[model samples]
Target: MVSKILIFMLWFLVWLLLSWPPRISSFITGALVSAFVSFMTMDILVKDRPSGRSPLRYLWFVYYIIIFLWECLKANIDVAWRVLHPKLPIRPATIKIRTDLKSDIGLTFLANSITLTPGTTTIDVDKQNGYIYIHVLFLKEGCPDHDMRLPVVSKFERILKKVFE
Candidate 1:
């Protein structure tokens, strides 16, 4: 149905991007690969049951991508500055934070978003209790058990909740 076609198109677009300078053969190959992957994963992606989510979820997801990229850009600059500087201001720490996201997709998206951002990696997720253990390059002075203005998580989680929760 519509969901499958959308998924196929998305995968194909991603494949096309990755296989840049798209030749006819590459296009054909990408199409085939995208179709195959979509076929394989559509069941998990587009469940038969009515999801009851508004179309606005897709819009929110698009906005989420924009936010994600912006965050990544900022993180990249911060990490680069830290690396280039003599001090290499990095305070590596793994701290656990509770998430309000209840759905598996929402939690996974939040975790992956945290992992994708520079200087942060999702070490573990306690899905049952809604906790995420994240390893951050810069824990910002006060951490481990104290309240710190975590450079990541909140922004992405807020949007992800709208998209997936």
Candidate 2:
């Protein structure tokens, strides 16, 4: 019940944020939409599980968002530098990386994070074996060493493991 309310409130807040200069009519509409969606999806959203009930977990999710934004900024700058440089210093490579995340939600989050970044795209995911194939725009020389871990991938996976697993 509490989780349902939280999900409803989250959805309404997002709607409000997206609908700038919120009017009374928009507020009512957002409320109705949020309520309907929440009622329909609460079970799937909250998973009827007790693991993520703590307020501390919410705080951790906020912390993860901050870290993700910072990484996004860095990736944007890196990609911009590569694009504007005279030599076009790009060493593209498709590499297979192993993840420790067990849940589908966690793995999906990791994959989306990789794709959201400027220079990396998630090519494929092998959920059974816990492998994600990613294509990177700027690869260092002597890369693709099977055991190498990319900073963006590893850091986001570490944070998401805490958030989702």
The candidate maximizing TM-score is: 2
Worst 10 residues of 2 by lDDT: 48-57
Model 1, span 1-165: residue lDDT tens: 988999999999999999898999999999999999999998889866347888899999999999899988987888889999998788888888877788777887888888879789999988887788889888765554444335457778778877875
TM-score of 2: 0.80
- Residue runs of model 1 more than 4 Å from their true location after superposition: 11-40, 48-50, 142-151
Off by over 4 Å in 2: 18-29, 50-54, 142-148
In terms of lDDT, model 2 sits at: 0.84
After TM-score superposition, the amount by which residue 152's alpha carbon in candidate 2 deviates from its true location, in angstroms, is: 2.5
- Candidate lDDT scores, in order, read 0.82, 0.84
Give candidate 1's TM-score: 0.74
